[model samples]
Target: MKLYGIKNCDTVRKAKKWLEANNIEHTFVDFRVDGLTQADIEAWLEHTSWETLFNKRSTSFRGLTDEQKADIDQAKAIALMLEHPTLIKRPVLAMADGVMVGFKEADYQGALL
Candidate 1:
């Protein structure tokens, strides 16, 4: 399995700890350093909608102006995510069959554990 998020993010840290504790082997892709391409974002959007992909609750989103936040659609969301990867809700888990946008403990228990 593959997980994508920044090393400094708390959610990402929690997810990594859980995986380690459970003996779940996962490859972590650090967005802050490794970076993500537009193509990668597009592929993730295929499995999950932009609404789920974008981290509207994050400080990154909070820093955007009201105008920048307005009239947001899938394409616009994708563009923003490409520019600011942190705006994309973190630790996107992916496999050959599918992908998930965020790190939820319950969800991980069901799907990963």
Candidate 2:
């Protein structure tokens, strides 16, 4: 399993802590430092829509120009996320079976535990 997010993000920290507490083995990829590939995003897209993965409320998204934010499609969203990974939601958990876009304790319990 792999978890992708910014290292300093609170949500990511929580997810990492939970995984460690539960003894779930996972590789963490820090988006800001480790980087992401289009294939990684594409693999995640198989389980969830770009709309779900795109974090509209993030500071990175909010910082975008109106022109960049307007008329967003899947391709546009993916491009934005590639350019600014912070625009993607926190703690994206990638497993062999599925990909999860965010951390919810209940959801993690249902899926992981």
Candidate 3:
């Protein structure tokens, strides 16, 4: 399994800790170090909708102007995510059969167990 997220993110840290405690082995790809390409983002966008992948609740989104938020369509949202990867809901886990985009202890236990 593989996990993609920034090292400094609290949610990512929690997810990593939970995985480790459970003895679930995973490769962590830090976006800050690995960096995502448009193609990679597009691939993820293929599996998950832009709305799901986009993090509207993030501070980065808050920093954007109302007009910018209003103008967010699929393409625009993709561009924004490409520019700022943090705007992508984090710790996107990719497993052999599925993907999970965030961390919740119970959900992880249910899905991973």
Candidate 4:
């Protein structure tokens, strides 16, 4: 499994700690450092919707121009997220079967523990 997110993200940090404590071996990919590819995003989209992966409430998204934020479809959202990795949600875990965006202790326990 691989966790895709920024090092500074609180949610990502919590997720990492939980994974380590539970002895769930995984790799962490920092979006700002390691980066991501279109193919990577596409693979995640196969299991989840763009709406789930795209972080509309993020500072990166809020800082966008009104026009850029308006009438966003999957294609546009994907492009925006690619242009600004911060626009993608935190702690995007890519497991063998699917992707999980964000961190929830209960959810993590349910899926991982």
lDDT of each: 0.87, 0.94, 0.88, 0.93
Model 4: per-residue Cα lDDT over 20-79, one tens digit each: 999999999998899889998999999999999999898998899999999999999889
Q: State the displacement of the C-alpha of residue 33, model 4, in Å, after optimal TM-score superposition.
A: 0.4
Lowest lDDT block of 10, candidate 3? 39-48
Q: Write the per-residue lDDT of candidate 3 for residues 73-113, one digit (tens) a residue.
A: 89999889888888999989878776788899998999998
Q: Candidate 1 on 1-113: residue-level lDDT in tens?
A: 88899999898899889889889998999988998888888888778888888989989999998987999999889888878889989888887778977778898889875
Tens digits of per-residue lDDT, candidate 2, 8-108, equal 99999999999999999999999899999989999999999999999999988889999999999999999999999999988899999999889998999
CA shift at 41, candidate 4, in angstroms? 0.8
**lDDT of residue 93 for candidate 2:** 98
Q: TM-score for model 3? A: 0.88
Ranking the candidates on TM-score from highest down gives: 2, 4, 1, 3
Q: Which stretches of candidate 2 lie over 4 Å from their true place?
A: none
Question: What is the descending lDDT order?
Answer: 2, 4, 3, 1
Off by over 4 Å in 3: none
In angstroms, what RMSD does candidate 1 have relative to the true structure?
Answer: 1.3
Best by lDDT: 2
